[model samples]
Target chain A: MHDGILTIDLDAIVANWRQLAARVAPSVCAAVVKANAYGLGMVPVSQALWRAGCANFFVATTDEGLLLREALPQARIVVLGGVRPGREQGFVEAGLWPSLFSLDAIERWLVATAASGTSAPCVINLNSGMTRLGMSPQELQRFIESADAERLDVKIFMSHLACADEPGHPLNQQQLTQYSQLVPAVKARWPEVVLSFANSSGIFLGQEFHFDLARPGAAMYGVNPTPALPNPMRPVVSLRLPVIQYRTITEPSWVGYSATVQVQAGQRLAVVLGGYADGLLRRLSNRGEGELAGHRVPIIGRVSMDATIFDVSAIPEAQLPPIGEAWVDMLSPVLDVNLVAEHMNTIGYEVLTNLGSRYHRNYVGGAS
Target chain B: MHDGILTIDLDAIVANWRQLAARVAPSVCAAVVKANAYGLGMVPVSQALWRAGCANFFVATTDEGLLLREALPQARIVVLGGVRPGREQGFVEAGLWPSLFSLDAIERWLVATAASGTSAPCVINLNSGMTRLGMSPQELQRFIESADAERLDVKIFMSHLACADEPGHPLNQQQLTQYSQLVPAVKARWPEVVLSFANSSGIFLGQEFHFDLARPGAAMYGVNPTPALPNPMRPVVSLRLPVIQYRTITEPSWVGYSATVQVQAGQRLAVVLGGYADGLLRRLSNRGEGELAGHRVPIIGRVSMDATIFDVSAIPEAQLPPIGEAWVDMLSPVLDVNLVAEHMNTIGYEVLTNLGSRYHRNYVGGAS
Candidate 1:
């Protein structure tokens, strides 16, 4: 009786992680459970992954790190958004490691460590070429030469890939080359420091990206890390929205908000209880498709806030789902997130992360 | 300490509702608090409206209707998505009214009423020119003639306008004309039954469209009901994201995932702790603008799941807030949800409904 049912295959997520782990064998594979595991519920997904052998977890903010700590007390949690000023003690008190992006942040961590009287091992994020976060190679060189860098217990030296999804992009090689140059200096300072260089897509880029530790987020949640090739991971989520209203077009008329589209007299329509507010993505109106009674149906008009109308005339009259009993499958193994992303003109990560909280979440398969 | 702060001015919402209520003077103004009051926290918004003389409230689902019933015990709560078959008892037990789209749904409500041995009132949804839901005019006439119609309490006869946002759309007049003819017949059956004909945008379509109860959702939350005219409602929400990493581009560099955009040397950039996952649409990459210290900054690249990069070189170094203290304003009175929606190629409803739950929610003034 919920708006829709969001079925998450925990086994599929675990299998995906295991497959990536096997691909990056010998290198420690860390799980990136940030953004609520890309909007699939962080606690449950991380617990499933933790039980499956994953020990290290990466999240976006300090709050998420604290939440993951509460969920899996023994798992190594790293906050990629780093420590906010004045909130540093909470990180040290919770035993959650913060990823330091700048020297100023590194200095703040040192201050927190001194105040808390705790040895907080932190990750150093390097800006290889993303130009989004972290210190540049030159900054890395300058920091390593400074005496303050020696006082900190640096656990991981990590950098992100800007174009890892596109293997042919020259920036991939350039970023790899730039980050590789700083490895020796960092290793010289801290021989025991783990080097993490690859993300989900980066793993598919090659062993050159495997490094010592790799953290993959999108791929573990069933996104296609290798977009150029067929998806190797099992589909991790399936969504089915309940049809609340079923109607037959009595005349030639417009449908949905703004009367964006039309239907003929013989057409049949089903209004589902989920819409853009439920993460159907308003841009998907009149573009997306749904599976109803094993028949393909086209969305007819602008998606409303709480309902989406689909033209279900393709199905035989006998197979039409009665109003309260039938449900429309929006996402399944055949219609995965990548396909939905394509229709929404965005990436799979955006599609997954944008999934709303109005659904009845059901988890299955985590035995492995 | 937080990723960002989302300030919701509850007073503006109440003011907007009152303004709309005055616009349709003598007609009861029902507040549509569906989709978590368009993602502004339903309970608070509904309670504020309830205290300000609003008695009728409409929600999208049975769950929401139940929640609203619990929040404002004395207020009339109507479930627009209607009652599921087996879940009908919950609605009758809770005294939650449902919008019945079909005669079949009406029969189910009757069954729930008989089983509970309590009288239940429901709304009859008319298709009016929108083929998305409800019975056709011919079916409505037939239902009114049925014996079952005399046994139930029909409190409101509601029909949604598909083109009310567009004043010039022919469908508005057509829908109005069709619904107007049913008024006499429906009144003969239930003289006390209220007629709800307008949503947020429909209220602007003139008084002829406003019947007994006018339900406004978006306009009450600061979405411009009249799309072609200047927004008259006060802005209700403002969002600011913390800058976790601020750096000056030292060389020509690409930014964010896939390396879609480049930045010149000497450019300053700030990576904020909110991205697509946090309701910053991914399409806003290289297109959206944010304000930092009152200076406008353009977004630099693709919004990641947890971060977005803004080129903040326009701000003078002396005026720049230190790394953790700086926060970029994504939404404000000037940069309201409508403007953000324009950049996202969507609507304000989509913008408001898509706001994620990760930020610190601060609710301000609700004083009448």
Candidate 2:
């Protein structure tokens, strides 16, 4: 193929979900399929998980929820980014739960459901020190007493962990304490509302963090949720880009855009078909390396918009594959996304989310 | 809008192309609409440019070339990334000009055309200075002698400038000299062939750099081709992400994942719906600022996958727009892609290319 192929192991994704589900036994594990399942095709990933007996799926917006609903008719679809006042009917009509982060949101949801003449559920986002998207404790207190609050049915009391990845971060315990305080009062009012406390990292923060339900996203997709420890999940993604052109450095030459690096004579450079535009982040320019013929090859100079160059001088000349037949590994088990994330000066989630759309995506080993 | 709206100005794009076309007067201005027109809709951008007297269009691959072909049938489309051996028929059928960078690629093209029994055109990429792609000076000599080469219709002799953005980078003059030396021989061999040089920045390197045709991509998309001076191109993109939630810090509290930043008492924050997954590069965390109610709101902590929080304390509480009513600017006329590119520690092209797929894409002022 002229373009790069992004091989997504759907069986591994299913296996990862099963492992997480098994870990948080009795506590239902939801699949967070937000950001197009972190840039892996959402429809396929969610379908595979659903086939594996997973029921709950979380998406960031109404559009994502709607798309996932089409793929999985009976699965519980929740829109984490709350549906707007006008947009409430779509969520209600579709039976999709929109997370209500404020009293105003809850009030509107109650009104919308009443007008629709049918009651639907929602996920109430509590501000458990995340300080991001959620209702404050003061607002939660007012919500508890409000007469209109009784009309609303919040199925999930979800509060995202702020520092769940860092097991030792004080905020993890602090957030747990704050969230735990409200759980009793919230449980008393809702009675059967599912308490979802742990995110991907929170599950690894121990059983205390996993309350009634756990939604682990990244780790299920092969990101090391517990970064300090060895990865427990199977590698779920691998990328291979075709080496379009290879040339021998007959003379000392400055390589790629801006003349960033000088390559000496006798060096062999192979230009691959992927670049920063393809989610091979610009920070991976010179610092990144890839697997080739069981040997490591270093990327040289700046990565162009459509291509990245690799120094393949280490490969024996006779062993070098012909121009069109050679394909280089950008992400194998050895050169995983975590290592790429380190070179990118970002996290594993950002790496997964940024994987570009130009690749020929191949989802393997899923139910046909 | 619940999701971030990426407002693309097709009128501005046309205006930018016209301005560049005027700068390199008498030289044909080809539009490089690869990478989905630098993440703006390619079909709309190319159709608009084609209407504005652009006779030539350039794309990165056969797929992009074919997509553009379906949109604009008459316009010349050149695939910069040369077509592979088995993929020649599709390019041939689509009438797409695949750039042949190596002698091997040219040989395959010769065979493919021979098998198909049709004579189509191609662009021959020359290695002038950018050692990333194209053929060396010696390879050109070898190509000239080969009997198979003469059978192929080489319509354009194209070479890229490595340091055209930095007119003073010395490689510009060196490349121009090398390219100039080969042009006469190439013209002698294929007299009807168009001699092309200069990228977006090359047009600014003075008239001499303009040979016969100049394909400028970045400046046409509002990226500052000339970084040393004020941007000559009109702004072509504006992004407004809706504020999903607003919260006040009642105590000294940490923010977002990793607990990267802290806010003191009485400070207000607005969480926008767009995040690193939406092409808001994580590098913008803490360092990036946005416009809200004429006040600069600095982004606090790390940018999450589906949201970014901006410290909105500067905006008086009384003036704060009701939760969903307010929208913050990530890229505007004042906060252009070039500025965002600077904050991302990369070029403007990347900022444009990395713009995510989740946004509600609004193309304004294009032909109906």
Candidate 3:
């Protein structure tokens, strides 16, 4: 097979989840399985996490929630993106909980629930300081004063962190303060409502941020929750690319598309079958590095749609394998996802999610 | 329903192919269906192209070739990445043509053919300029001198352009000269061997660059074949993202993750359900622009994994639709793929291929 191999260590993922779960002990550690579990196959990841005692799962859309519900019959699946106007009945029918971000969303949910004659559980998202989602303070106040809001069966009151990755960012403290004030008002209305505030990065922002539940997404996939410090999570993914061919230029030659890299005489190059289409960003052109026989090789020239060339001159001739039968490590323990993200001028989350479906995915150490 | 809508116009694709084909009349116009037809669903694209009189198809790897073979049993499918050492038999058995790039690949193909007791048709890739693949001049000479190379059945001799996008780049002329010299030498060995050159952009470099076969990939997908001139091809894709909610912040607030953008009071923000995980690059944060009810809005702060907030203060309140039932055009006729690529400092090719699978894909105008 010429396609690259994407080996996902489910044990490492489980270990990362366990590590984060241990860090925020006594608090509910919900798994965020949105974006197909960050593009690593949601069903498999969710199944593995469910087997590891994770009862609560968060997904981006109602469709994802339905899929997760199908996989985990008894788990509490929350739709983070909430329900689209006419799609509320679908969410209700699937027994999925929608995180009502606005007063309008709450009203729509109430209508769906009243029509079904079933008081479906829901979550209220309060906009602390992040203006992206959730009900604004004024909206929250108006909803809190309304009888309709009180009539619905609210399960969890949650808010997303805006600057959780940077613990020292002033917005973190500001958001925490806003969240603290908002939760009390929410508790006054629904005294038994569970509070969930912390995300992957927020879990590391101290115990105050970690309320009743912690929704960690990237951290479980081995992305560093605390970017300023060492990662407490174990690496989960390793990508190995198939070497198409190896060539030694006897004269000065330009390599790859656009002739961006000029190679000297006797410079050896190995063209690998992995490129931007495979989630290897074009920004990684000439900047990315790969490993061959334990030796580092710098990628030369622009990354093509389906292939990239790496300068493998540094590796000893004895260490190099036969041209068409060799595989090089593009992403591994040595060159982790985070480092590759840095090379591409993005975060590990983008790198992970952008991983194409072309890879031959292999799952290791998951529940049978 | 919160997922973005990616509408692909296959008729526009057919139109583009017709335009390119008309430009190089009598030269067999082959379609490059590599990278899942540049991440626009290969099966549908190939079927449409095949019906449009496209007899030849090119793919990146053997796996892609196998898929195309399953779809088009009678079409000439060429594997550009060539056959891996022990995998040559599979390619032969599947009746797929492998572009042999090196002398070693030729040797392995001979061995595989000997073991299978059947001669498989193959193409010879000559390293005219782009050194990423194919045999070097020295290697090509050695192969031509070998008796084993004469035993194998070769169909076409091809080389890739290095700088076809740049009309004035010296490398274009240099590669053309090299390809011209190499093709004649190969023809002397095999008089019936057809010559294939010119990619999408190379097709616009005039008839001289267009050999017996012209392979166009990006042009058929609505990418500009001639970057220096107006795009002769019609747009093929349009992406529309759902607006999850609209918020009017009355207090100072941060818009998205890391608190990248600080918003003033009375600022209107609309959170759209599309982010980097949805193939929108993070580099587009605070730079990308989306259209809401015909008004362009700047994306605020950092784009989260599942959401992005757009500054909709410029848009009139009366023009805006209901919060939960509205959608903004992320990529449309107003905001094309090329412009979006500019915001991320990349090309339209990356933007098209990076499009995530979560979107509800709708194919319009093809074979009907």
lDDT of 2: 0.89
Question: Worst ten-residue run, lDDT, model 3 chain A?
Answer: A316-325
* Model 2, position B309: C-alpha lDDT score: 95
Using lDDT as the measure, name the better of candidate 2 and candidate 3: 2
- Evaluated at residue A15, the lDDT of candidate 1 is 93
User: Which runs in model 1 stand beyond 4 Å of their true positions?
Assistant: none
Against the native complex, each candidate's DockQ, computed on alpha carbons, is 0.86, 0.77, 0.79
In model 3, pairs of residues that clash are none
**CAPRI verdict (incorrect, acceptable, medium, high) for model 2:** medium
CAPRI quality band, candidate 1? high
- Candidate 2 on A152-261: residue-level lDDT in tens? 88899989998888999999999999999998889888998999999999998899989999988999889988899898989999999888899999988999889999
Chain A (alone) TM-scores for all candidate structures:
0.98, 0.98, 0.98
TM-score per candidate, in order?
0.99, 0.99, 0.98
Q: Rank the candidates by TM-score, best first.
A: 1, 2, 3
Candidate 2's chain A scores what TM-score? Answer: 0.98
